[model samples]
Target: MGRLHSLRPAMTSTDLIVPDPVFRRVPAAFGLRWWMAGWRSFMQAPLPWLGLAVALLVLLWLLAELPMGGLLSQWLSLPLLAFGVIFAALLRKRAEQARAMTPQGMPVEPQNEGTLSSTTQRWTGRIGPLLLVSLLVLALGGVIGAVIVMGLGAMFGLGLASFGAFAKVMTPGVGMAAGLGALAGSLMTLLLLVLLALYLFSVAFWFVNTLVALGGVSPWNAVKLSVRAGFTNLAPITLFTVLLLPISIVAMLPFGLGLLVLFPVLSGASFASYHDVFGDEAAA
Candidate 1:
């Protein structure tokens, strides 16, 4: 009787305490709902889109200059980059303004308006200096990262070549078997590259999440939390990414014109994803 009673309670406890399903990372996604919300929000205040457009155009123009070089190219690219900064500052101001005018019709906080306006002024006041500073910093970081990745790739290639030679000697009887093995090894290497890409993307997303979560604490703290939550909820992130893949391919079909809509939606959804995970703490 005692054994049966103990087993009944154990069964009841097991029934009561359900284990969380590993695959259910994302809250029930309503892609249409998220897309509609993102569209409405972006359309209501398109300054952020405008800013991104300006940045993209400037980047394209600069890249074009490389092929169509000369004094004119240099003159044009330099000025466009400068103007892109002004547009960014303006866009930031408009974004702040839009945030203040929330749909709730709740009384907009006076302090919020004041702080936003102050930030706007500061951004506009020293746009040139800040842009130059940012450009130099980004260039340096890009160069260093590129060098490191290139070095790693060279080392990997050298190792693969050595392996190919060893495989040829060890399996001489199996004609072309060594070559097939090398090809398979190359495929495995490619898979590793893809994994690395995902890791880098995860890191980048965490960084952006931290940047967007400005205030309340240091960016480092935000980064730590973002990375932790992202890994914890990888299932949803993976699902969303898979869903986006087809959309991205379609967007690229029309010479990237669809990107204007697709890009903003993705950006807003990223913000939404963060909001879903961290709630108001991230919203701030």
Candidate 2:
């Protein structure tokens, strides 16, 4: 009883101190390692991981069946799915910690029968904050997207207006050249805006879910920290994004069924990447 009591404080104390995230400069190949690590973690408890993934898929499918379901799924299902995967990763991480503490020859203690129920309760309790953070991120992304669209619209309008003014005074060949130049400029502007939006959306909330799940950090603080960490490690992050693009497309190709495996693997990879970049101070 005394030994058990002594261990309890150590477990609880880890959760109390929220350390500032640390960014690391990893090799481009580290992205592949992160994906592999995710696969190993999923294999550690495949059934439970798959069950969670399937539940999320079902929930998303049901949401998609509703009116304007595509948007609804984005707004509602994304946060819920994120919460579930992060929570599962947290549980797996905790289990890993517990096993590490067990003696080499001795068997680890069995998990309590109430563990699943308790975890579910805890997940439900914390979901409000997760959902709030998700919505806030979405709102921020929307604002940035709108600003980009409006700016592009203004640029395109200006280009067209200038082309119109010049066309009246110019020969037919000169007018054609001016119109093509304007068209090319407008297309470039649109592409640049699209890339900018993707970059902002990716970095803004990359680590928010993990921080919230594992560190118990507030949503706002998590966002601030995530953005800072993301920018600090932009090269590695860009590599990761580039590498993940094809895997993501492949995951969607199989009637979206590949997501059953790829989704959890991606979640695991995110968790692994978070650990690598930020260091697991809370787990330490």
Top-scoring candidate (lDDT): 2
Q: Which one wins on TM-score?
A: 2
**Residue range 1-284, candidate 2, lDDT tens digits:** 00111101111334666455556666667777777877876666667677778988898889899999987888776466555445445555555656778889886543434434544655565566677777777788788889888987898788888888888888999888988887787789779878977886787677787666655566788788888877776766677788777988998898978788877787777767776775645323
For model 1, the local distance difference test gives 0.47
Model 1, position 215, has a per-residue lDDT of 17
**lDDT computed for candidate 2:** 0.68
| Model 1 per-residue lDDT tens digits across residues 1-284 | 00000000112223554221111134545344445545643564466555565565666657666755443343343323323222222333345555556666664331223432443443344344333433433454466558757866786677678767877677565735766676677768766775666555453343232222221223344344445666766656665666777988997899977776665555555544544554433233
Q: TM-score per candidate, in order?
A: 0.52, 0.78
CA lDDT, candidate 2, residue 195: 91
